[model samples]
Target chain A: MILENNFDLKRMASQVRRDIVRMVYECQSGHPGGSLGCTDYLVALYFKIMKHDPSFNMDGIGEDLFFLSNGHISPVFYSVLAHSGYYDKSELKTFRKLNSRLQGHPTTHEHLPGIRIASGSLGQGMSVAIGAALAKKMNKDQSLVFSLHGDGELQEGQNWEAAMFAPFNKVDNLISTIDVNGQQIDGPTDKVLGLLDLHEKFSAFGWDVMHADGNDMDGIVAALEEAKTRTGKGKPVMILMKTEMGKGVDYMEGSHKWHGTAPNEQQLVQALNQLEETYGDY
Target chain B: MKKYTYTESKDTRSGFGAGLLEAGRKNKEVVALCADLVGSLKMADFIKEFPDRFIQVGIAEANMICMAAGLTIGGKIPFTGTFANFSTGRVYDQIRQSVAYSNKNVKICASHAGLTLGEDGATHQILEDIGLMKMLPGMTVINPCDYNQTKAATIAIAEFEGPVYLRFGRPVVPVFTSPDQKFEIGKAWMVNEGADVSIFATGHMVWQAILAGEKLAEEGIDAEIINIHTIKPLDEKAVLKSAKKTGCVVTCEEHNRYGGLGESIAQLLSTNTPTPMEFVAVNDTFGESGTPEQLMKKYGLDSSNIVDAVKKVMKRK
Candidate 1:
């Protein structure tokens, strides 16, 4: 399902943004900030960039795999997974419900089709992606593995442990990206805790580092394609994707307040008006 | 009472390594990962044979655990090797989320368990690993008694799906269990049958319980000895049947008395049978630098301690 045209990709991204805000606003108990921030990148990855299967299997052999390390932004993940045809888009309404598969964090416990690991405690997804990449290399499968992480989540020490592991082992089959939104739940990441020069840090740890604009649909698709070309080299690739805290909505944009807070009904109507509903809403 | 003896003593970790190698030979999906303790974990053989299948994470237990979980996503059975302390406490969140909660088929093989880790002192010795691992939902906890049982368990868990915690020790204990014995996941092995008192033992303490049984036979106590290898899905049927027949119970282990084999049994019996019982374990304290024998004696986990506990428990009965 590779959408090579930029128009189609942007349209899907608009619909995904609609799903993200509606799902969060309907529940009033989800993170809309990071989810909106990472929407274009996920939409591009699932629809255009990555070679994946929507009819998912646990053993995703010979296909590209994506792991959501920073699982708090599950609204975008669930929306993207649904729009990508992994499950019913109507299941999006069940987000954070009692028996719903869409947990507060992305988990494989409920047999969710796309989610392969349970995450939310923070800083565990990289290791899991590396392990899956290692398994791919062992099975002689040439397919690549992709993972996304939050920039604030790098404060955890376990991420550093994985940061050292992937490149040292020449895990060239993995391309991990960090959502550099610079905002956490409390405040800005720089104020909460400084993550000084992630590009230099990851490069020092021996990864081929790249940077891209996460909000731009065309740039994200191009960066992902370029990242694919960089695979099978000596080192694993890291993309420092710079995105806004709240990307689409007007009042939420560039603010840390909406990182986890959902919009009110009037605000949701305003947000929906701001972004045209490209496809029918779930 | 049945007689039990061994001509040689071997560390249970060696059995794990042997079993891992055999499992790797049997199934190519069985991969091994270590946290810079390959020599200590006795994983040299597995690494030597299947270098491509082995991952040396260089002292990152958390990464190793999560990576093991990730490997399962692509249909690989990963066996993570490290000391019990690092295996459980240090990376508990990683195991709880990625492996246990995610239901990944990762075998967490831990060596140097309990006070028997000896001269490594309190920091390295982890007496609460069994409790920590067993508490996780969908985690199968197995503390094998000896070399053969550990090896059998290592191979057996590779076939069984989902998460498992296999705990062994650093000390060279008796290899009394048969080399040909098939390891059942939650089944208890009846070591000896008697009527006075039932002694349930796990890990290194099973051998000590056998010695206690011999001593009790001389005193006409006729202690029933049962080896409880799997601590999580405990064989409640075997435990209650033995308790009903023997009327009294004693539990032996080389772990802390607070949350180890003894507590599991006590919780079971207190609910179901409510039989009088005594525990021979480390009394909720840290272990210091000493020989394995000296630590066992000082911590009241020796065969003599089991004998004393049996006698005292019988009095309560």
Candidate 2:
């Protein structure tokens, strides 16, 4: 596992947020709200919590693997993957471009490093993560499979199906996290269709459910470390991470308007200015 | 005319069961997933032997499909077993995005395909599956003709990489193909050779094509019979050669005429051979509850139908 002392995670989180906004601004199309919201959690995992290799082998045997279920948040995922040294960080500029490896959504067909399955469709990542976890068990590999999903995406029935499966089959090596920003394309999750009590739903599905303040880097790190301890018992672990939509940027924070919208030239400058260039811009 | 006969009949789903068991024995990476249709899909033997490898997703076809796609990441060749209706139409998006577009090495083995899934009626029977599977890019769609062929195809796809849709059916059908025959994907098997008309059939229709060839020989109208099993990467060379010699073609399958083997053959002929053609398939209608025999006759998917189509296409020629 990589040590948190090697680099300042707060600085890295700021840089990741900058990458997210710039990616969406450059493309004029891409998801930014959820990507910004989930930045700190990803920074904590990739930089401190997870044991992974940046050389980027798809098989990912004997190494911790992560899958982004809500693939529209490609900006944050691509940035985190690049910053973690999976590929040349300059490739972040090509987000959503024709023939670029950085597709609008994460895909394996482009042969992108660090991505095993393509997941733009909501509620699919949990099942894939469970499958990988099952494979890890079959191979006797001790590493765990991690996946992130949008809480609004849990409204998809497939998540519940997979939710029931992981715990029943004793898939204890998997850790599934949900970005509970409570915002989707249509509106607030509660207004569109309330996901009443995620903790209860997951607990009823026989998972070891826990909550985290997703925007807080330390809290995410502590919660993830705690989740790791909960593994290998008998049930899968779920981190119900509560984050604000567009957490970093002042105007975009805690609103659904920026859920999928790109910032204008002036707004881009404003958003980027809010995030410190701790690691410099790509 | 070459003679073909069978002393016994067996369901194609049992062929899948036997084939899956053999695949599991041959490769440790071969895993099976079923969505509450273990007995129907004939995956019981596989589940019994390799209980750890088999995943019972319990009525969630979408989850089963995606999980199979995921398993492929760790070098596991996943075979998802369920009825054809739930396999193709029910979870098409998941299959398209996660399996097809993602290009995962997943074997979507489907049983009880088409109108032959009798007594269960239209809701259970999926006649449009062949079309649905074939349209996906990089998907290999194989509808094996009989028990032996289905078993052979099931075993063969485990060796071949990439996504495949193996369509088979319920009801006992004659096992004409050899059990030891090499099942090659995207290749046509020449059942019989003739000069007057070409009869290309798929799925459960190959036996009927052979029977039609025999009756056509008795009528002095020589008919070429070919089993076109793999539909997506069609045997273009074989199709063109036969269509050129016969100057007419008759495509048979237990599927809708709109997107079945007939349409594929029509596209092939229009592009390469431009041969006159007739279709012995369902014409845009859903199936009703009945015996497999009754459905075959009513839907014009029997040997008599093939013979009649051949005669009609010959007049066009």
Candidate 3:
């Protein structure tokens, strides 16, 4: 819970972005675009905000819970979790390989810490996050629940169903963040479908809505702080985080094509050069 | 010894509600989550009594299912409440990935199952839930017969830690079982002990099996009735033992004949203890709006149907 508003979150996000690109390049089959874009949010949450011991314990009781709704972007989540000590940092090379805990999507079966639910098909993670938050409330623990979803994943009706249910049910202990990256697998999200007025939409759905620059660590830190302060007030909170499709990677940035595809070796090297090897490449 | 009898009938969903409330009191880790069907799933009492332990997840069954899976990682036992259809079919992938495959200990409490859901039509009635859930690797499937049994199954599965599919129904039926009868998962309940033919049944079908047993007994054909509550682990021992003794089997359920208890029984009998088998279940078809009894009769799921299937299987034997 001791999150420094500083530590150059942008630089940390840059390192996480490099991890996303390099890890995907090693795996040769992972989502890098959304992972790169969402690096700041994940980094800010795990490295700064979250109070978790990443020894990767199976029973994550008395600890904060995080669910990945748009789990295709496992690259960023894996990087953040690994960097924060959920597993051997060297395990990043095993991503998407057979028998790796870091699968192409998030799953708890592998006994990985920080991931409580297996999510690949979009729009289910928030409900599970609310479930854990409800469990925390029942356990009389004040730990919060955090989750992230893609802008395109909001098109799935389940998100709105969770949207309507959370506030009305007083799931105020959950803090859900949406990666409003405006780009998805096929193309730019507007071309795919306009995720129109996401802020007002969640507001109408009975959530206390906030907006922040997802790629800006300061904004993420500040918004997350506000999200925590808003809990226990009888309403769920959602942060509409606007971020770029491939934030730190120069070539992959703003490309929907990189959503599920991995960066090649040359591209990985270029991405790494742009980002300092802060924790050293896994 | 005195036998328990039913003076009245009640919906199995209420039994689930009672079980949920009891589990809430007994286990501090027990939590309930509903997908907007508070009244239909009958999770209102648990929600009211343990307001902090209850979660209203709106109509997001997929989300509700996955969330229940997550709650288990925190050592909290989550029982998900929803219609049989939405609980299984709508969110099969979610349950498969999170709860079943991940091996999370989430109790999937489904009500208003099969044709007995009535008036709401086929959309609400789920005839294939047993099949869908049984396919999962570590899933424990149970379809309780009556109020006491359903309530007992609910409380029992909470003690045995794992993923469970607890199926019950909407309509009021027989409440013959003892109020405090302890439920044993994957164990068949022998309601009658005759040698003519074995009637293996579950859910609301248990009452019909009892009625059919009486009718068969009246006709000089002795009948044996067994309640196959826990469908997945398939009480193979009980089923095979009874089938071996009887030499003929008739499987009855309010679900589809394809993946319901019958198929499992048929498979077990063919490989392990092959016996002539007949199924009194819904043939691959949909349900419609009608009284539950009317639907039971029309869809060939009533007591008479069980009698006919038994006689038919007996002739084959």
Candidate 4:
């Protein structure tokens, strides 16, 4: 609710992209590909779409819930959360450091605002999203639950379990999106474990599936709007976002190698040049 | 000898169902979720009274655990229902991350615990649940003795914030705990007091310990019976005081000997005040399909086991 009218989601995206690099570089380890890929969409969700308070309450109380199912990309999730006023942006430098609130995987025990559950183990956030949606239904609150997952994480049997559950149980208050970067740690998702056709799979599971260019802020915003319309229909909505491994930065773009390996001093400088300090470095 | 009047024996899960309905009425935030085990977990009352508040997740315990964790974020105290096997070992990672590590105030209500689950066999019975839940850093594990205590504990956890694991049994057991006794989380309740040996028991074993103490008294053995309901953040003061005075101890539970209440008591005594102790529990084995009484005896978890363990430990004293 503290979101300002002057808030430019694109500016937020740029700053987030910068922090994504800074954190990965500082930690010398993190998933930059998916983090870079989801920057614009995460920006749209936090800066534009969702309503939350930055005073950092774990129990969001009357506020919308955002869950990160694929927790390895803590760099991007951390950047967006820090940017949105959950914590001092300067705290971003401490990502993955000992005793830091921002661990390798995001944890609510740290009492960070906007994050409800810890979901480093993928395929869980969807169910967690449904549960939160169910809570909203119980409380009679109209707030929606949002969750993001990696495309590779779909291979987890629990994802299909949740996919089957949300639709069948009428968990319609949730909007779940997948980070379809098509790349994971081992190799291309097809090589590691072929996802085959994600759309048909989700469609068969009864989710209202929508595809979007995740890097384009406008497309993400529009798709989210379309997703919102699909809500209250007694069926959960899934957005399959097509994105480059490294979307904005040219050197790291389109490769799974950047998925977890962080940029060194020179590489970080090169990456940061592509991302302007719109909101300043976190 | 006076003959006791025939009343009724009910599964503790039914008590949970009754308690859920009452808790929903008392607290506006208490919402219940079940992964297709509503009838089995005895959550029908809550589901019937508050349909909007009850969620039927359809045989997905992993999803159920994570979702319950998420619900806590919006200031909702979610009580997730499933069998003890599904609730603990099946979804340990989900609970570890979402509920335990994140410290979400979700109540993991596990029904049909231990060999008492019966007939369904080892696949259903969960002897390791107490150990599994207690190992978590910030978890409060409670194994209520009977129907009334199970119901009371269900209502009790709603008010006490933080993560809780409420374990209950499936079989129809004697409901003898005080109907009006308040459910306190970590304080052990002194059921009866004697001096020869201290009998610290939990879950269905509480009633068994009482029976064993009564039998031991007739044989000129003085026994102190204590109900250690809350397993984690254990009532160390009560345990040590009784063990130190009696100079001997016997721990009983329908759980594994490795990480169950026996191990906890052993640790307490070995570290602070060492005392002779014997364990009356399953000895590194799984249970088979049988009646509740049969499994208890086969697994050596009956009151006779407690009685024998007490005598053995007292010999060391």
Candidate 5:
């Protein structure tokens, strides 16, 4: 369902944010900050930007594919995938439970339809996305491959290896976006390890770089659509999506405290009050 | 006693290259990835024939492993080639998460395994690879004896779905196995039958065990020799049958005795059938810069070592 208007996208984003908080609150564990921050971007991609099938297949041959590299934000990924009709939204209740398809970090081990790879250890998703993109090119399928990564994940060396590989091989069918929320578990990414000028870094590595406000649904949708236009031009695309550490709920925005903390009863009530039950709770 | 002979000596890595090309020809879904050791891995021919299907990952084993996992998502069988050390220890987490845990159909082809990697020293040679890989659930570990067996195993794994660790070596060895042999994943090949003692061997050690069997026959000991190619699934039926007949066992491999084929056999026999056993493997220690022959001799992994181990285990029986 291609949601053209901003109203539907915003409503969906609100519902996704509600789902993210509630899922974390139910489990009493999970990263909610990045999930809430990346809600609009995921909403825009699954609803408006990407041409994907709800009836999922492991070999996503003719359809666009998305991989969640920063899998700690599985709250948003699970919510988006469930809302996109990949699985029952009721399954969202079993996020971190034993024998649940939704693992703490996103994984395909349970045969989850939307997840294509297991990703808890950072810096591996870029290579996986590139491989899928290359496979698509080999199969003569023009559909794009998209992936999301965290800015702190850039600390891992494998990402640099993949960053060097994609453009050199002319992997133009890939669009990788980094959630530059600047917050990690210990503290901000700049304090933990400064990621100096990501745009210049990616551009120097031979990628066509773009920037967008990840919190703005309209901006995210426009940037993703524009990224599709940059495809097949002989270089991979990189989007430095700037967003707050947490968005929507008061007292959680712009703070790294909620990065991996589940909301308590009072906090859950406060968050639910802020995010309207647009699509109803699962 | 059954006799074995070879017309020529060949490296197992070349067999992997040949098998890869044939596997690629047989199934177009088979793709090859190398981390800047194309020549060492002997993947030149496969790259030549299917340049489009080949990926040069340029000295990044982690990226190569994860990419291979990704390729499996779109129905492509990706074979990642690198040294045994780099393939396992360097990118263990990558293999664990992306390939093994995810259940991706990725073939991790590793060359230069064990002390047989020769003069590159301890850093390059990996002796604990089998233990590391076998520990992972759902991982199929194979260490073929010679060129022909490696080739057959390479082709066989393409048809079998799941993550596979195919460990081969650098130095040329006797090509005694048949070229047309069918490589079964968990089936053990009985080389010479005897009721005295069962000699279980893998990789380069299999040839040593054969030589030991010949020597033992001359001594009237009558050592039964079995080639255990697949280390993970481990032909338990063959092992139990051989152990039951022989009453004693000896395991030989070019790896640490702590976590190699010997430990797996010991675990099996301790529970089901109690039997006397001796291990002809490197004691828990790192290898040094030396010739393959020198390393094999100094590390107590030669035919003489196997013969000595057989004699020692026969006494326990």
Candidate 6:
């Protein structure tokens, strides 16, 4: 899929950040800090890197597939999926509401367009991604499988289980990215539990590890493209992306307090003013 | 009561192995994953026949369950093979989130259920798996009675389009059920017909119930026997029909009485048609290291227990 220059990827990232704050404010619930932090990475993946279809099909047989392990950041995922034409952007209004396809966490139960699995429980996406990659190999489909996970969620033992299985099984058609914002729900990840050398840890687990600045669209796109090249070479790839807790909103930045709490109306206005309205609000 | 005779005895896990091979031949989409218990799970034939479709997930049951959920995404029918304890309780959160709640078409084929696992002690012998699996929404729970029925169920669940938990046993028992009998998901098979009492049994308890029926017959008391293969969907029509005829019920299973077949029958009867009932199951206790026969006898899961339950339930009516 060729990148459409006319549709500026950076501009789309700003719009997605705006959507994240507004949706969280409207619902009076949801995680805005992580959502805003991960906006640029998701925007780059959907708009620039991934060769997926906006004509949503659950079984992404011939298309690139993605799973969200840290599903609390549903705002950015919902926004990118909508703005990319997976669904109507107007449906963003139903986020976290009863009878809404946009659930608090990503789920396939409601027949949501882009989501393939329910992943709020954490540390399950990489394993699921590996399974899909294995299926793609069986079917001789060269499409790659991608997944995003939280730095804190890596504390879950299941991720390490998957991390071990992927390289051992030679699952080369998978690319997993970790949002290394250094903050979790409780506090900063280092204060909570230090993940001293993430790259070395992944390297020890037999994965091709790379580093990226998640807040920068150029760096995010470049790292994702580099990860793709490393595939089909007898190992799985991992990109440790460094980002801020809240990249756009001023007050919410650099703290774990806004990890789950929604911004109030006045705060939402302040956040929106900071993020240029490249696209109109839902 | 009618007598049942079998030329040989085989473990239900072997039946699963045979059925897996057949299912693989029938559909190219059938895939198997094992958590480092291939020989115990009896999946060698499948792995040998279709090497590419088989995945060795090692000792990680959580990863195995989640990966099975993922394989279903690209239209692969994934059957995860492991011990019952590891299959259900050990990785329940993964099954709940990725498989049950997402409604993935993954078959959890669990062997070594109940006391019949033998000598592995209370830790490996999971008596509460039925309750754990049955409580999950969109999960089909099936505990086949014998080898033929287990083999049939293994193939049958592949055709069903939702999460399924197929529970079987490790000990070699009578292959009394037919080799050619068709397996239906929520349908009950009437073993013997009588008016005195109705005996509903599943898994290893079916043979015990049959034996109990024969003993009751010689004593001039006729007993009706029904083999309940599928536990979740419960075959309400057949259960209610038998309960209405006999006016009393004796539910038997190789599981805990609190959340097993007996409790499900009680809930069904109390709501639609209240009836006198007795339970022939492990009374909320764990099993210890012993032979299958010794454990069954000690835990009151033998034919004598069923006969006692039948007589007790008859008096209440």
TM-score pick, better of 2 and 4: 2
Model 6 ranges off by over 4 Å: A1-3
Q: Could you tell me the lDDT of residue B119 within candidate 3?
A: 91
In model 2, what are the clashing residue pairs, if there are any? none
**What tens-digit string does per-residue lDDT give for candidate 2 at B201-284?**
998999988888999999999888999999989999999999999899999999999888889889988987688999999989
* TM-score: model 5 vs. ground truth: 0.99
Give the candidate order by descending lDDT. Answer: 5, 1, 6, 2, 4, 3
Candidate number that wins on lDDT, 1 or 4? 1
Q: What TM value does model 1 have?
A: 0.99
Error of 3 at A3 (Å): 8.6
On DockQ, the stronger of 4 and 6 is 6
Residue A197, candidate 2: C-alpha displacement in angstroms: 1.0
Q: For candidate 4, give the docking quality class from DockQ.
A: medium
Candidate 4, B-chain TM: 0.97
Per DockQ, what order, best first? 1, 5, 6, 2, 4, 3
- lDDT score of residue B303 within candidate 4: 85
DockQ of each: 0.90, 0.76, 0.54, 0.71, 0.87, 0.84
lDDT by residue for model 4 over A61-132, one digit each (tens)? 577778889988888888888777777789888888988888788877765655667768777888777777
Candidate 1: tens digits of C-alpha lDDT, residues A193-256: 9998999999999999999999998898889889999999989999999999779898999889
Against the hidden reference, what TM-scores do the models get?
0.99, 0.99, 0.92, 0.95, 0.99, 0.99
The 10-residue segment with the lowest total lDDT in model 6 chain B: B1-10
Residue A144 of model 3 has an lDDT of 83
Can you write out model 5's per-residue Cα lDDT over A27-142, one digit (the tens) per residue? 99999999999999999999988999989899999999999999999999999999999999999999999999999998888989889999989999999999999999889999
Q: Name model 3 segments beyond 4 Å from true.
A: A1-14, A56-61, A232-234, B1-6, B35-48, B57-60
The digit string of per-residue lDDT tens for model 4 on B1-317 reads 11122266777898898888889999978988887888888888787788777777778889888878767766788999999999999999888887898788999999999999999999989889999999999999999888888889989999989999999988888888767879989999988888899999998998888888878988999888889999998999999999988999999999989899999999989999888889999999999999988989888988888888988888897
Tens digits of per-residue lDDT for model 1 on B191-307? 998999999999999999998899889988898999999998999999999999999999998888888888999999999989999999889899999999999999898899998
